[model samples]
Target: MSGSGTFAFTVHPRGRLREDLARAWRPLGLVPEAVYDAALRRLPLPPVTMATAQIGGERVGDVVLVPFGARHLLADVVGGRRRVGQAVDRAVALGADVVGLGALTATVTAGGMTLGERTDIGVTNGNAFTAAIVEDQIRLLLDRTAGGGSRPHIAIVGASGSVGSAVTRLLARDPAGARLTLIARTAPRLDALAADVADSVEVAVAHTIDAVADADLVVLLTASADTLLGPQHLAPGAVVLDATQPRNTSPDLRVQRPDVLIVDGGIVSVPSLRLRGGDIGLPDGRSYACFAETAILALTGHRGHFSLGNPTLERIDEIRARARELSHLGFRAAEPTSFGAPIALESRSAVIA
Candidate 1:
């Protein structure tokens, strides 16, 4: 494939209320929430074009709406799979070299693995670059918390996930040596991931978020829509990297805890790419690493399915290497953002203590 390769990333409404606000549904405000929910599913909103961008001939991408919410898909996984497959096929029809899955679409499709197996066109969950960014943020946090020559304890809430597992491997291979607490719902998957890194670094597995209570650094990557982290689960001066869709960090944590810092996961600085139309849910010059992954793959001339299923270290490193070779493209983790703005570290109470 050439550098002019085209990519498309998929998205869905997070919830009915969010969609109502996005479409300015004041006229429909009187309608009951359950009515709106059923109407959305039965109506099957068509694929809407959310955003489109092209940076000369280096890269081209279109973000299209999948019109499905996490709850909708999770409720009917079989139908959700069909919807995802159909959506990718339509994207391929629109000249997409690779189709990227976003939101709950990835979780429902098993990290785009199912679609990759069914479609000839390339498919990606964009986990490779997302994993790289997570590791980069974790490294920065570790450096900030460096003290006493005491090895940092890293707890990953979704250690069995694509992004989590990739970073788990990357961190374990680091010579500085950090103890890892792998927390996830499934014991088998957690054990498997732990075994991969247990020899390289001390590893522990936990099935609850409480396991993070004493961790120096915690990474959240679960698909859970609920806030699982609370005040009791946080350690003083700990760093929380929240990379989940619905956000696993409790809102109360912000109101009550002043010593725990957060580095928003998945957001990356993309200073060069210019958008002429549509909003990508980011301020100018910033985007989610998953969306950036497909764009980078296009720029790097990768023409096959990438970042499907669980990610590997080799894939993460490869994507990062390819990204660096592009001129004027600076891809790195962005600072923690609150309410659409990046917050200064010194200004945050989490860093004061």
Candidate 2:
């Protein structure tokens, strides 16, 4: 497999809706907040190429803006999907080998399948590797904090989703016994996911976050833009692995509950990477797993939609295999980080106290 091709992914506004707008353009700083939001509803800037890097030869990293905030996208999924489809069109025009849905754009498209009709080129939500990273970190957390003999109670908030379901199935297969609780907004979907993993381990399904309070560990994979988890929703000394883009954990939750451990999930670091036009809330070398997925596909000469819909064990394993093949080039998972800071063993172990 030759590593020669162009890769691009869609990006949306990060941080506060109005502030994100002002940061992107200096002129918007003077515009009133009300008028700025009103303009965003009616008029969206066309797919703009914010930053691109030619990482030796044909290996190009292009970051394109879909130009909408998270709340807006969550509110108007149909419109967001259309906007992301347009962004993919821009990527196709640039001769991208693969286009990826970044941030909440994947939520809007339901892991990229909703946009299938809009493009002949492959589209991926990059949930496969995202799931993989979270799974790895959880294993590490459990091994370190619970010792090898204990089966810490684990709850997945978005257990029916691509990332959440993949982790649930993966953990279920592990030899160490751990009681699993699948929490999601949809009861039927939660039941379905529980059924899928029940043979390997015992599973309890719930339709709300209430089921998580008793669990030792919690994983958030909900697609909603809202901050669904807080101190009240979690038991003291609980560990949370959050994989959502805008993040399901509230800043206030972190402030009020120092006893709880909430680690940012699926954040990876890419080697020698230079990206502009967006801030992924990391230093320079790191990125979200979904974006890293597209980059790996491009460099590996992998064509077709690599990761889409709910992630599977096969997809998770495949991405790891690909990453291993190119491990020396350095597109792999980084250390556990909460918010933007690195999480230490002491920091995480305190949650078990």
Candidate 3:
């Protein structure tokens, strides 16, 4: 495939109020779902445009957007897969070379395996990139914490999942020999993952939130659509990377613990494609790494499934190299943000003691 031949279609759940108002206004002819639907069918969303750049010295193209909203999850629960399928198909029709499932779409599609099988274009869960970014953020935290004579205690929430498993593997290679904690709903799977990493680092497993209580650095990648981490679960000076899009960090933390640093994992900025009128809960010039992975792959003319199943070290190195080569066009983590603004990590010596 030609490098410029790569295009992307992103399927997101429809916005709740938009969908509801569209339905309510249909009888009055004030809003027409069909017209909006036809427009999406004919053109990719505007603020969502093609990013022209080189990844690994190869050119690429991308299509970006906020698909539907959170209600789509409820629709899926009510057997509304057809609506989701329609959204996916629309992107495919718009010259998309591959379609990336973002946030809930990824989880709904069963890690992109089912979505790939169903869509005409290639599909990626984007978990591999998420895994990579989480690892990177963790390492940065470890370095900062170690400067103060505190050896970081690493914790992975949802450690049994594919993304979590990949994170465990990456951190095990840490030369500081940090203590590792794996938390998940299932003990058996946690035990299995722990065994896999036992040679690289000391490992412990817990089947509940309490597993995170003593961790100095926590990576939240749980599949649960609810808040899992709060002030009570963390130490005073903890560094957390909330990898889940809707956010795995609790709102209470913002009100209660200003001393902790929480960074949104997968945040990145794309060059040349300016976001105009969409709100995907990101700072200006920032995007999720999963979104960047698709854009990077497209830029490099790579049509294969770059991130799928359990990501390996080889996959991480390949993508990292591609990102570096495309440095001029690549994405970086947005500054540390919590509750819609930059977080100031205050000295917590009083609290720590």
Give the lDDT ranking, best first: 2, 1, 3
Worst lDDT run of 10 residues, candidate 2, spans: 344-353
Off by over 4 Å in 2: 22-32, 53-59, 147-149, 347-353
Cα deviation at 299, candidate 3, in Å, is: 0.9
Quote the lDDT for 319 in model 3: 73
- Separately for all candidates shown, the number of backbone clashes (residues 3 or more apart, or on different chains) is 0, 0, 11
Local distance difference test values of all predictions, in order: 0.76, 0.78, 0.63
**What TM-score should be assigned to candidate 2?**
0.92
Candidate achieving the largest lDDT: 2
Which is better, 2 or 3, measured by TM-score?
A: 2
Cα shift from native, residue 242, model 2 (Å): 1.2
